[model samples]
Target: MRAAWAIYKRELVGTFCSPLAYAVMVSFLLFNGVVFYFFMDLVASNPSLSGTRGPLQLFFGSTILSVLTLMIFCPATTMRAFAEEWRSRTAETLLTAPVTDLQVVLAKFMGSMTLYAALWVPTLLYALVVRRYGAVDWGALSAAYAGVMLVGGAFVSIGLLASSLAASQVTAFVTSFGVIGGAMFALGLGRYVFTEESQLRFFSYVNLWEHMEHFAVGMMDSRQVVYYGSVVVLALSLTVRALAARREA
Candidate 1:
């Protein structure tokens, strides 16, 4: 635990020190600000467009853009986890340390998760701003944030897995982006093509769009929890295996 904590601190500090991390943070805020502005414009043009949904819900995952934000920045933030270590030939030193593979993976994962959470912190003001003008459903807002965290966790794990497979940060970013973006596109397409209840159910099971919608409405389905939990576990497990194989090689 002590070793893991040390690695975790190093990882977090390293990320904060990187200029790319700040670039990502700024870009994320800019993109989200534009998205929210667009939503407000939409509601202004057509008051009925939002209906019962609040800004938080629409901002979270009700739109494709919101999901795209996750698909893009999550990879951007995690691209360097292992890829940079390998690129600079520092991975060998880390791997050869006294830390076990599991501890290293967990520590790095937590570090990435912490950074991911930081990226979302500034957005909380969006909620507060909304509360001042109108009624905000705190329960749904909390659920929406929870859902975003789950999605971020899953994406971070996938990004780490991609980093493990790639030797450079750019390659890691592209790999993670393609895998996550492709899956999201494919699942969304499947949702439309499969109109049958059973088929739609299957798509919905893995559809991030549906997951966010459920959360945005305060419908905390246990199935949604299980789905994302499985994704996080599976991706991280594969990441651990990938690191082990790399070590052996």
Candidate 2:
């Protein structure tokens, strides 16, 4: 446990010190700022708008915005997890340092999640900013944050596994992106590809966009929670095994 903690602290410090992390954070905030401004401005200028939803809902809705954010930042944050260690020949030193593979994987997963959380931390101000012009739904915004964290657990673990499997950082990033994007797209196809209602319902359970959309409106469905929870566990388990294989090789 001490070893794991040490590794976690080291990785977190490394991430915080990296120019890449700062660049990614700044880029994420800028992109979200533009999106928020556009949505809020639209709401203010258009008086004929329906009372169906708020800017927060649209921000977290089943659009390409969240997806784009994940696509860019998650990979940039995680692509170097184990890949850089292997590249620099430091992985063997750590793997042989009287630490279990599980601990190592957990440390990396957690370190990446810390960086991931920092990426989203700036968006909290969006609520306060919007409060100036409109009433913010605190309940739904809370749910949205929970939903993002839940999905990030799985997404970061998946990226960690990709890093463990790849020998280079670029390859790891591309692999992780492909895995995450392909899984999302494949699950979404269930709505159009399936004829049976029951089958479609199963597919809907794993649809990342729909899951977040549900959270955006303040509904925390148990099925979606279990889906993401399972993904996080499964991905991390595979990552541990992958790292073990690399260590033993």
Report the error of model 2 at residue 195, Å. 3.0
| Candidate 2 residue-wise lDDT, 20-115, digit = tens | 788888988899899988877877787565265677777876566876677667778899899989999898799889999899999998899999
Q: Candidate 2 has which clashing residue pairs, if any? A: none
Residue 136 local lDDT, model 1: 78
The per-model lDDT (C-alpha) reads 0.85, 0.84
Off by over 4 Å in 1: none
Clashes of 2: 0
- Tens-place lDDT per residue, model 1, 174-225, is 9999988898546756877888999988886888887878888777778877
> What 10-residue stretch in candidate 2 is worst by lDDT?
46-55
